[model samples]
Target: MTRSRAGGGQKKIPTALNATYYAQRASAGLMITEATQVSSLSTAYPNTPGIFTSEQTTGWKLVTDAVHQQGGRIFLQLWHAGRVAHPLWHPEAATPVGPSAIAAQGQTFTPQGMQPYVTPRALEIAEIIEIVHQFRQGAENALLAGFDGVEIHGAFGYIIDQFLQDNANQRTDRHGGSLENRTRFLLEVVEAVTQVWGAQRVGIKLSPSNTYNGMADSNPVETFSYAIEALNSFDLAYVHLMETSEADLRHGGHKIPTSLFRPIYKGTLIVNGGYTKETATAALAENNADLVSFGNLFVANPDLPDRFRFNAPLNQPDSSTFYAAPCDDSTENCGFEKGYTDYSFFSQLEASSRAE
Candidate 1:
């Protein structure tokens, strides 16, 4: 699920209510929570969730309790929007921070308005260490919130991805330029979070070819391959990869099997993006990935794993409601009521005989 941005106009989904939503769909083998900010300044979009506040912690506890009651496993996705963030979202209206002062060349949706991306302040070495501490604390908060594990958001055009790419990280210090320096922040954050969650409870999400929000690595292949190799030392629980986007096709354009990196790393691999049931099965059969993560598909179909297993019809999510509005005060108030969320599951729409 998508996460809310920090200091956004929308109020956060109450934890007691989010628990109802997640608990209602506990059939999946695993459920990944919406993108959650590690720090207040890390907010990318308005209305996104955060791991920083005590209220947020107390709120997530409701979600975990509901999922656990139904024997479901859930992972919290820790995120930082980086250059995609707008100044208005910051508490002090401070400029966003990244590996460099480069701004994303796109629009960022914020509470105030759709703002143009602004050049961010490059982080200092000490600030980098403090950011790693934020991630560590976020991981600890996730455990306290009752999540089974935590997934570091190192993909898309987020802060970690920015630091991993040379084009975005033009610094000369120990944190930029070369491959080693470029990936330093990622390594530090991983190590810091791993120290709290342990190897088995920590997973990472990465998108090597993604060029979203003006992210372009001069040598993404070399950068990511080296990154995977480095991560081997941590023995992480899993590595989730969003394979092949518009950015990948433009740069290098090499479509390697998701399994290509499987042998290179020693951990469970989850492949996402443009995957079908057959494709997911093939990925598992070929040992390309240990698991598959479906975003839009799963968002609409709460019983996705069951639908796939039983060959049941899937629900088509209403694109309008994906990020349309906040959940209403009443748990029964569906997103569709506000012209936002709509999906007809097999159990609710198709013939009962065809339902699983």
Candidate 2:
């Protein structure tokens, strides 16, 4: 859910528009902000927000304060794009860094336009340890920004996903070639972040059946089973799991459902992927998951929980406006409200009907 409207700059500070958008959706049980870069080199797209700098942390405080005014809880998602990032976003680095030197087979949105993925420099062991520290710093920054917690972005073919999947990680080092080795980076990051926020306020996202950014595992079940079971050692807030999408299946991904890991995971499990009220209720009723999360549904329906309560119609999402709109002037605001904060609430629609 990267709206990509934080505005372009070295800081990539969250704008007032971001505060308004999240505040409007404050009705969600728990609001998780868009994937936020943990460091300068962690960016893969233009205008995504960051948590590393003082200015960015201050900007996020606006969002947290606004949401808290409405009695809402929020978590900042910490992300590192890794090989998915292009040189356009990280000119200081030689190239994007990953577990191995291989490049993902896809393109990423950049300031220049969509560019083909590039081969990344394999990270040294010391560099990997530094990245773990970066995640720790991000968790600390989240607390400073007034977030209720922080969710590590280990899903969606990012740096952690690149290490977890074998196709993207061909190294024979301790970071690759085995389930334990591949998951080491993720565990270290989790451990580091937990030290800052403690296990109860930290969560990790995993997409075992994900096929985006050329991600695939030789054995997803075994890989994720070990990862989920290992998480039992920590009393985390929740483990967010994504169901395999149609796009994943089209890309030859294994049909490893999130339910497969429910039994293995020893804590609260949150399942996501195109869930409606009915399916979400069924999931909770059948004990398939402890909780269910909505992404796209919440995008166009800011008062989504109320809509579910009243069985109201939903506002259709405009995919074109899902991300930041192009602006001729780089310095001007790009109308982020068109498909964002402008989404009408259920009460507004009912009032409109009464007036008509």
Candidate 3:
């Protein structure tokens, strides 16, 4: 979940509010920070954090230190927004780059306002290689920032997904066409990042049936099957799989369940997508997944693990404040803490009831 509170600048440094937010949720078995840009060109939305600069790295150090003090493990999610990014946010107004020149059929939040995505410049082979290096450098920076590990953001119709899915990638070059060719960029990035963090400290996320950002594949089962099997070669920390959502179905996406890939993947599998405590427990009991990740639930219930242990009621997330918005006199507790760090813990609720 992108909190979008990193304050505007070329550096996009994480603020103390970010440290407070993650530290509050340090009870989770593992905490993966919001999608962080690998470079300036990776900008997709205003106020999102980046890990490319020295200042940004130092800022993340605050977050890591806070989490570690609470005995938590955190992984930085490295991201490149690719064509989903707009020139309005780029330095000198550079066009967004992708595997092909096609533009996604949607608009993205920009400084000017919500703007339709522009046709991106097709990345040359040399440029693709450079982006791989950028991921590697981001991994090294994560180490400097004192993160437990790094997860490559290969899912969610981003740069790597742009290459993996045919709808966004129409190139006739070696980088397109077959499944092997399309997966080349993802593999190269994984290889490069693993060189820095080693396989045990790295993970990759994949959303096979995701249709967000206008992404679709003619044969998602085959494409992702091969990708997951190939990952067996690397003893990565885990392969995070997102189940197809209602939004994906409404967009005409194929229903490729995580169960379909469970047998194919050889290592740790972390399943996500609208999971409740019952469903997550059932998944583990049935050996469907090694772990289950929560997004919205964690956002609202900072002490989620304790809530689950006690089978207590949860705090529902306020969708309007899911992402950060501009502060104004009309909005109370605006900027970072409204729907963020202010979510009460189960212990607090218990104390309140006792007082009453």
Candidate 2 segments whose C-alpha is farther than 4 A from its true place: 326-332, 348-356
lDDT for model 3: 0.90
- TM-score of model 2 vs. true structure: 0.95
TM-score of each: 0.90, 0.95, 0.95
> Which 10-residue span in candidate 2 carries the lowest summed lDDT?
324-333
Query: Which ranges of candidate 3 are over 4 A from the true structure?
Result: 326-334, 348-356
- TM-score for model 3? 0.95
lDDT of 3 by residue, 1-356 (tens): 88877854555888678899999999899999899999899788767899998999999999999999999999999999999988988889999999999999888888778889999999999999999999999999999999999999999999999999999988889899988898889999999999999999999999999999999988899889988898899999999999999999999998888988999998999999999999999999999999999999999999998888777889988999988764322222445778888998888667456556
Instruction: Estimate every model's Cα lDDT from 0 to 1.
Output: 0.78, 0.88, 0.90
After the best TM-score superposition of candidate 1, give how far the Cα of residue 34 lies from its true spot, in angstroms. Answer: 1.3
Candidate 3: RMSD to truth: 2.9
**Candidate 1 has what TM-score?**
0.90
Q: How close to the true structure is residue 216 of candidate 3, measured as C-alpha lDDT?
A: 92
What clash pairs does model 2 have? Answer: none
lDDT of 1 by residue, 314-350 (tens): 7776666676443333343433232122344456445
